[model samples]
Target: MGQLLKWLAGMLILASLACLALASWTYARSEAYLRSFERPPPFQLPIPDDEVTRARGDHLVRTRGCRGCHGDDLNGQFMWGAASAPGLPQLARGSPADFEAALRHGIGADGRALYSMPSMGFLRLRDADVAAIIAYLRSEPVIDRELPRRSLPWAIRWDLARGRDMAMPAVMNRVPPLRLEGEDSPLSRGEYFAMTTCNECHGLTLQGDSAFGDEAAPSLAVVAGYDEKAFEQLLRTGKALGDRELPRMSRVARRRFATMTDAEIDDLYAFLRQWPARTTD
Candidate 1:
């Protein structure tokens, strides 16, 4: 009996030691993975101080879901456990180049790759729009708020180290460039809006993604089933044809798409209606 107990104790100690080693390795590898991305070249855009530009920026920020992750006050907000979205107003005080790097490239001012930012969605944002966003963000007064320090869980770190999960910088690289350019037609404008906004929840192509598991978004091709009125209702009130509520889409639309102007909605709907044809090509 004594010999058996000694063996069990030894096994327990070995298991603990193994866990410790695995944790150490995960931490090191995760740090290395984060550091692997090369800092992108500095991007420059002239941030306009004019009210018209700033108002446009304000509209973009309000409708583009910027306040959804960041707090409504532009102060920092706690996201998932241990992760916090930093205060944008404070962060916006940085150079336009720094803001552009973060918005379009997922690169932080510190030259490190960001993790939670959905830069993949914003990768194709027009330079003028980006400049406006930076200008608006910088124009706001910084409201000081205490936020939890951002940290990754051991499981998430392990995933990052093993390449099971991609950091935002890596994900941004996978986003395709805009296909429609130069033309100012409604279709072109709509494509820009959907790619820059919808692609965050939908797939990078706006073809939909099951990555969110139960919250998976269906392809925008589903838009074909909805007439203009139904589509408008979905965007405005988060209701489907039968007034059926979608788990994620309902909430997102009410929060983000609800703020879109009638003209913008018309453009988006027009583009989405023709999305199936574009996919075939």
Candidate 2:
């Protein structure tokens, strides 16, 4: 029995060592990936000082899930800090060019490709809207708290190395083009809005892309079943017509979509209504 126990302990040690080696390898590979990108030429957004532009920017931030991840105050948050993932950053300290780089290109103010920010959705954002968002961020009262720096855990590094997970910049680049080809109609406005705001959770194609290990995101075509009133209620209340629990969708609705303006909701609804028909046609 003593000899058997000794053998088992040896095996356990070996297994632990193997796991550590694997984790180290993944960490090295992810570090390489993070360092591989180069920043593009410096350019700036026309950040306006007007109250209207700032207000518009604030609305965009609120509705676009920025505050949900970053924090209600736009201060850096330990979103994943308590967990193993990286913390979201405060946006107010950067220049307009820095904002543009991060928002449109997934590059951080430090010129590194952002690992956590889902910039693909914002990549389609109109220039004016981007400018407005920057203006709003700049106008926000700076929160004085310091957040812990972001750090990916070993599991994330392993997943990233194995291609089971993708970095934010890679994901952003993989998204579909900002505009549908040869499309010029009021529907285009709706499409742009959906792509910029809804695509992160749904997908660039609005088909489905579940990143959180839940069931695949349902196609937005499901919206076809909803009338305008039902849809608006869902966005505002995060509840289905029958009070069905939507989990993340519900939480996100209250945080981001609850404040959607009537026109914005209508525009989103118009595109969603037509999306299924297009798929079938």
Candidate 3:
């Protein structure tokens, strides 16, 4: 009995040591992977303090789902286990160049690649809009909120180390460049909105993703099935054609798209309507 007990204890210690070694290796590999990304050149843009620009910034923040991951008050919130979304108000007080880098390039002020920030969606944002967002964020009063320190779980770190999951910087690189340019038509306007807003959940190309299980977003081509009124209803209420409630779409629509201006919605619809012809060509 004494010898059996000794063997069991020895095995347990070996298992624990193995886990520690594996964890150390994973941490080292993930840190090296994160450090591999080269920081882009400094971004220069004038952040306007005018009320008009700030107002537009406010509108963009609210309608663009900035408040979704961040709290409704724009204070920090606990995302998944150990991952906390930092308060934007505090972050906004930083340099405009840092803000632009994070917003468009997925690089944080600390020169590290971000993890969960969806910069791919915002990659195509116009410079004026980006400046306005920073201005509005800077103008807002900082609300202090207590939150846990952000940390990635071992599983996530392992995925990053193995390249099974991509950091924000890597994902941003995969987003295609804006194709429609040099025009102020409704198509271009709509493309801008959809690319920045919808592509976060839908694939980066707005071709839809089935990998989300129950919340898989269909291609923007599905919009062709909806008329003006139905699309409006879906955007406004999150209801589908038969008044069906989508698991994630309904929640996101009400929280984000519901705030879209009528003209913006009209423009987005116009752009999506051309999806068939656009895809064919």
Best by TM-score: 3
- Report the lDDT tens digits of candidate 3 across residue range 1-281: 99999999999999999999999999999988877787777767778889999999998898778888788988879987676888888888887788888888888787878887778888888889999998888888898888998777888899998989878888877787766876898888988898898888888888885222236788889998999999999999999999999878998899888878899999999999896578666
Taking the tens digit of each residue's C-alpha lDDT, what string does model 1 give over 184-218?
99999998998888888788877876232236777
The TM-score measured for candidate 3 stands at 0.92
TM-score of each: 0.91, 0.82, 0.92
Cα RMSD, each candidate: 2.2, 3.8, 2.1
The models' CA-based lDDT, in order, is 0.84, 0.76, 0.85
lDDT of 2 by residue, 118-213 (tens): 787788887789888877777777766766766777777778778787767787767777456358665787888898888887877788873433
* Runs with alpha carbons beyond 4 Å of true place in candidate 1: 1-16, 210-214
**Residue 176, candidate 3: C-alpha displacement in angstroms:** 1.1
lDDT of 3 at 34: 77
- Candidate 3 residues lying further than 4 Å off, grouped into runs, are 1-13, 210-214
State in Å the error of residue 229, model 1: 2.4
* Residue 143, candidate 3: alpha-carbon lDDT: 87
